[model samples]
Every structure is written in C-alpha cells, then in structure tokens.
Target: MISAKHKLLLGVAMASLLIACSPADTPAAGGRPAPAVKVSTLATEVVQKRVQALGTLLAQESIDISSNVTEKITALHFDDGDSVTKGQLLVTLQQDEEAAQLSSARADLAEQERELARLEGLLASQSAAQTEYDQRQTAKLRAQSKIAEIQALLAERTIRAPFSGVIGLRQLSPGALVSPGTSITTLDDLSVMRLDFQLPSLSIKAIAPGQRIVAHSDALNDDFDATISAVASRVNPIDRSITARALIKNPDQKLKPGMLMLVSITTSEYDAIMAPESALQSVQLQHYLWIMNADQKAERRQVELGIRKPGFVEIRSGVSVGEQLIYEGFASLQAGSTVAPQEG
Candidate 1:
C-alpha cells in the first residue's frame, strides 16, 4: 500500500476520471453563442375588416308580365328580348269583338244624347209629360254607363309595357290561347344591379348603408364595385344571419340579373399591430408569439387572435407597438433564451 510507483499510477487514474465526469460547456446555459433569429418591430397600420359571402344579383326592377283575361293572343307587338319603353304596346289579345262592342256602345250613347235633348225641349214647351222626360233622361244616362264599361273591358284586352325595360323571351306567341294570369314574359330594368347576401348577425353593429362593397362573378373575369344599400333589421332565427343588399351600377349593361357573385363588404377599417403569420406559435390550444426584450432575451407571450390576412395576423392584445419579436427560428426558443436578431 505504500509503494511510490503504485501510488502515482492511482493518482493519474483518479485525475482522468474527474476530467471525464465534469460537465462540458453548454451553448444553452451561457458559454456558447446564442441562437440566431430574425426580429421585427411591431408597427401600426390600417387594416380593413371585411366579410365575404356568395350573393345573387337582381334586377333593379323585375316582374312577370301577364294578362288579365283568358283569350287567344292576336299579335305580339314586341319581339322577344326587345327593349321597350313605358306605355309601349307589348301584346294584343282577341280584342276585335271587344272593339266592335265598344263602337256600338258609343253609337248608342250618341243616339241617346240626341233623344235626351229632344225630351228636354218637349218638357220645357209642355209638349211632353215631366215623367216621360225624366224616363228618357235616365235611359240616356244608362247608355253612357254602358260605353264606360265597354271601354274598360277593351283596355284589359291590350297589354302594354308598364315600365321601360328589356323584355325576356316571350312565352306566349300569336294565336296561343293564354289564360288569365298566364306568364307572358319577364320585364327587367337592368340599368342597375342589386346584390343580396347574408352576413353573420354579429356584424350588425359594424355594417351600415353607404359602405363600400366589391363583387366578382365566375361568369365575369373582372371585379366590380358596389355600395351597401340596405341591411336587414331582423336576424334570421335559424341561421343567425342578417340579409344585406348592395347596389351596383350597370350602366354599360355588363351585369345581368340572377347572376352569382362573390361579395365582399368592407365593414370597418382601423390601425392595428400585425405580425408575420410565421412568428405565431400554438401551445396547449392557446396562441403565443416569441418576443425579444430590452435585454435580448426571448419571451413567450400569449396573444388574442383577430382577423388574419395573407402573410400576417392581427394581434388584438398582449403585444405592444414598437416591441420587437423574433420572426424566424422561434420554434426552438424558450423563455429567457438568448437571441441574436438578424436584419431584414
């Protein structure tokens, strides 16, 4: 046990074991370089709050033109798809018989007027009894009433355009027997388009008339502009959404009724702090972001998420403007970790 050579060998073995057991310098602890990450300062900018939905375009004025009486169509005054002005004759039914009756009634009225004049003269001269004169006058009044009734019926036989519009395909042609209430064709004033869409009930407070709206149709390759014309007062109980209508001018007649359109309503706009979408992290069903503090230490912050746009997300709270955040290499970061921010 007291041999010098054996004791020297044991001391060397113990020193080697100690060196192996000691901890190596760790980059995470402090001795090595910190992780390199990209950082950006939070800035305020105007953000548009918008809602989108599928909508249907409607005509400014649309109606199904029909007839009041059942009869054979005698003539179609306007061709199918013809543009008609107000008071323009559109269709004429079997009105020849009615016109003859009206003419006969007018002739009878004229004869009765002459007879009534003779009866008044006779009564004034005492050549006829007062009762006889009164009876003739009553007959003349009845004739006048008959003419009025016939004229009314004749008017019903002629169909005229109630308003200026483009007429759709004619359903009934000449010589076709159409019943009362038969659909003749459609008349639409397409000078403007009305788009109807549904929006969430929660947006009621944010939407209003005169707000700007944009629309796109698969049928049309271009986008068009519109203005919010109305917002429904009542929310649908089943869907929990409200109806909204926007008006778009179609002066060039580019838009048509019943067209399918994608509508986007600009409900609001305001300044907000936005972060790059990649900088966000989700942990335990909660959203968080990595930030570099004044000391260059990484900190994890919980954030309330809002409307997200392309490449960026709105941070509603828990982040301050002018604060710097690590936008890259943040997945490997932890609280209190040192960070080297890279320039943009």
Candidate 2:
C-alpha cells in the first residue's frame, strides 16, 4: 500500500517535526537558570516588651472649696477658673458686727492697761492694796482674752486660698448667705498630674518606683512623660491586680483631673533575632520562611514567632543571626530551587 514517493515525503515531514520538538540549545532541567530574589541578612535587634493600660489623670491636690460659717458674702475676689496663690484672699464675708466688737475690745484692753499702770504706780507709793492691784491685773488678762475671741470670730468670716491652684466655677454670688458644709466651688493644683492605673500581680516585678512611663491623651492629642511614684504592696483580691501611680509634670496645666488616658510601660527589653515580615510565609497555623542556604538554594524552614513589630517579627526559635532569607519574589519558589540573591 505504500508508494516510494509518499514514503519519502512522510520521512521528510517526520524529520522536521523532531527538529522542532527538540533542539540542541534546549537547557536541561538540572541546568535551569536560578530565580532572582531579594534576600535579607538576619540580625539581632533590641526588642522592647511593653504593656498597655487605661489610666485616669488626677490633680496632685484637689479639694472642694466650702464655707465654715454662716455669713453673707461681701466680696468674691476670684471669678470662674481663676488662678490663685496660697494664702491669697478669695472671699470677704460681712463682718460689720465683728468689726465693731473687735474695736470695742481693743478700746477696753487699752483702758485696762492704763488702769494696771495706775495700780503699779499706786502700789509703788503704798497707796493701793495688793488685792486691789491683783484685781486690776485679772481685768487686764480678761480683756486680752476677749480680744482674742473676737479676732477668731472675724477670721471665720474671711476666706482665703489654702494652696496655689486653679479655682473652679463660682457657686454663690456676692450677698448670698453661705453656711457650714456649703460647697462654694472647687480648687485643684495642676502643676503635676497623678496618673492611676492597675496592673496584674504577675507584672509587679516589671514595675517599680522611678520607672519611666508614657501616657497618651486622646482628648488633648498629646503625649506626656511620667515617672512611677508608687506601686501597691497588696494586690486586689477581686481582680488580682495592683494599683500604680505615676507623676506627670504638667506645668502647662493642660491635663485635667478625671481624664482617661492610655499608658504604656516597658516591661522588659533584650536583643533578639528579627525576620522581615515579607519573607515570612504562613500555612494553616504554622509560619515558615524561605531561607537561602550556603549553596545558594532555597530552603523551607518552619519558625517559631513572638512579638510582631511594624515590618519585622521576633523570631523566637528556628532562626539565627547572620542567616540569609528571601525578602521578596519568592511566591513561585520551591524547596531546593537555586536562587540569585540580591541584598535587600
């Protein structure tokens, strides 16, 4: 069934097909060109372990300003939100009656002194009896005591700032009657802010007096530096946490009492091996990395992870310093595949 002419043509066609399928220049599998990849040399980085907590700010000194005596307000020296110095006069209540009594007492004391002097002169001349001179002396003492009592009564009507601080809103106007236990306003010393927070009992070792802390106020949109002032010796039984206090310098008086803020404390710090996040690959729950071995070939390694930073992750184990890992372009890589590493 075969013709010589047909057989010759078929042979030629077969030879052309073989030439197209296989060429002498076709590279062998073992000689395949290595893939180009970005690699990073692992190194140790000082890692900081920090803990966060919500804290409340309180003034160093705070008190409710109140009146101790029932009296009509004569003058209010401070307005709402006024800064006052310690011992500064803040209020003057009606003291007309007390002033009159004080004046009368002073006049009486002066008269008593004159009488005592006259008695001394009389005694020197033997014209006065000892009993009579003693009576004059007792009268002088009573007058002095009366004056002291009047002065004390007048002091109750006058109000003064007990400490340097910012005064709160006024509760009573001039001419209004105020009595004992009646709250007049509030006063707070803002030179330093007390930050209160609680930490777990286990973290007690990480915190101590004089330790540094940082606070962030979302309301003020600012950060503040603080130093630990006190740590609770007893842990709360209900929560197993201990309270902590930090002092924050606030000479600017920007921080207010009862404000909520975010606080951070460095629990510990140490050097640890860090791996670039880009080179890390995860499967299920385990993480792995594409490492470049000494032979310039890709090696798949399972690694243990710790804290994660912005662009790097802490390598707890399965990695060491000075090892090279593929930083990028490893999506199509296979174990044992040759790699042409460019430093990243």
Candidate 3:
C-alpha cells in the first residue's frame, strides 16, 4: 500500500496536523509589576477644641415707653432716636381740666380753713355746739384730701423717662388721642450689648461664667471679644440645648439690637495626637486611615476621633504619633500593598 509518491504526500499531511495540535512557546510566569503609588504623611500636633454658634445682639436694658393716663397728647419733648436722661420729660398730656380741678380743690380748702378759724372762735365763746364744731373740722379735712387727689391726677398727665437710654421715634404727635398703656416709644441702653444663644446640653459642663468668647457679625465686618455672663438653670427638653448669655462692651455703640452674630467658645484643651483633616478616610459607617509600616507596606487602620478644628482633628485612639499616614492615593492601594511615602 505504500508507493514512494503516496507515502511522501501522507507524511506531509501528518506533519501539518502535529503542528496545529502542539502548544507554542510563551513568556515567563512572572514579571515586574506596576509602579508603587506615592502618598503624603502627616505629623501629630496638640490642638484645642472649640464650639461655635449663632447668636443675637441685644441691648442690656430695653423698655417700651407708654402712657398710664388716657388723654390727648399735648406735647412731645423728645424726638425719635434721641438720647434721654433719667426723669426727663418725654410726653405731656392736656392738663387744663386737671389744673382746674386742682384750683377748685385749693379754693374749697381755703374756705374750710376760714370756717375752721371762725368755729374755733365760737367754741372759745361757748356759742357753737361741740358736735357742730367736730363736723366742720371733718369738712376741712375732706377738702384737703380732695386737693391731694387732684395733685396726683396732674402728675399722671405727664410721662417721664424711667432710665437713661436712647428713645425710639415718637408714636403719637401733638393732638393725638392716647389711652392708658399706649406705647409712646422704645428706650434702649446701647452702651453695652449682650449676645444670647443656645448651646448643646452636652457642653453645659464645659462652659462657665467669665469664659472668653469670640463673636463675629455680618453687619460688622470685624470680630469682637465677649465674656460669658450667664447660663441657664435648666436644659430645654424640646431642643436639648441650654441658654447662654455673653456681654460685649459697646462703648462706641456700633452694635445694635437684632444683629446676628457668630459666637466661638473654647470648650476643651488637650495634649494628644492630631492630624490634618485630609488624612482621615471613611468606609461604610466606620472611619479609617492608611498607616505605612516599617516595611513600607500600607496597613488599613480604624480610628477613634475627637473634636475637629480648622484644619486638624484630634486622634483619640488608633494610630500613634510619628507614624507615616497615607493622606492621598488610597483608591489604588489595599492592605499589605507597597507604597512610596512622600513628605508633607
């Protein structure tokens, strides 16, 4: 079955089949991997904890001035926004009727005094009954009481400032009908101002009277210093906050009532390890950071945190001081991965 020509053709076909089934030569199993990722390191520093809040500036003393007597306003001696001294006359009511009543009482009292003198002369002569003289004396005393009552009415017709303060604009003009308890204007002592704000109940123990605070207002482009004046006796259950008051001296009277301010208070001090805010990482509900070991391998670390400052945060637990922390390029690395530490 094997002629020379046929055998040569069969051998060629078998060689082609062997070449198709065989595996080709390949590269080595392992080679150099991708370059290591570069990251920055952070150093620990001591920091202080501070709390901030929004507050309102208010006058130390403020009152709404009003009239106690119902009458037509006869005169307004002070204009709106004028500074007034204590006991200064601010408003006057129509006193003509009151003055007439006073005059009538005084006339009646004078007539009673003359009658009393005549009764005394008659008593000395034994020409007047003892009961009649006693009645005349009672009439004279009643007239004196009438005079005192009219004087009180006249005093009520005039309104005076109770304290030294700046007065608001007049609410009623001359000839305006005003009733009892009508608000004439507001008086506020702006020499000293106070900021009222609420702090979290948890911070109540840390805050104390006389603690220094910094305040900034949008109305005023500068920051000012204030001292804690008072604290609330009880915590508010609805908001879980405590009320606090701070006094800021306003000698220039630049700050006004109703201005919103930002209050910053130092709550705590510590000598612990702190790191830049960028060094912290979060995974799921837990916070983490990458620590470079002595072998230059990236190690995943869980951390406990404390108060946060402007650019740094206090480390309560986990990493120690002087350890190389990866502040960047965490997305491409895993635990035990090699890292190139960069100074930061």
By the lDDT metric, which is better: model 1 or model 3? 1
| Alpha carbon lDDT of each predicted model | 0.88, 0.90, 0.83
- Candidate 2 lDDT, 25-86, residue by residue in tens: 34323446678899888898899999888999999999888788899999999989999999
C-alpha lDDT of candidate 3 relative to the true structure:
0.83
Clashes of 2: 0
lDDT at 288, model 1? 95
Where model 2 places Cα greater than 4 Å from the true spot, the runs are: 1-36, 342-344
TM-score of each: 0.76, 0.87, 0.70
Tens-place lDDT per residue, model 1, 175-260, is 99988778999999989899999988987876689988799988988899999999988999999999999999998888999899
Please state the error at residue 96 of candidate 1 in Å.
Answer: 1.5
Per-residue lDDT tens digits for candidate 3, residues 1-344, read 69999999999999998786554421211233422544544555556678888999999999887777778988999987899999999888999988998999999889888888898899999998888888888988999899899988888888888888899877878999898778888999998898999999988877799999999987778899999999989899999999999999998889999999999887776688777677778777788888888888888889988877788777788888777877777666778766666554
| Residue pairs clashing, model 1 | none
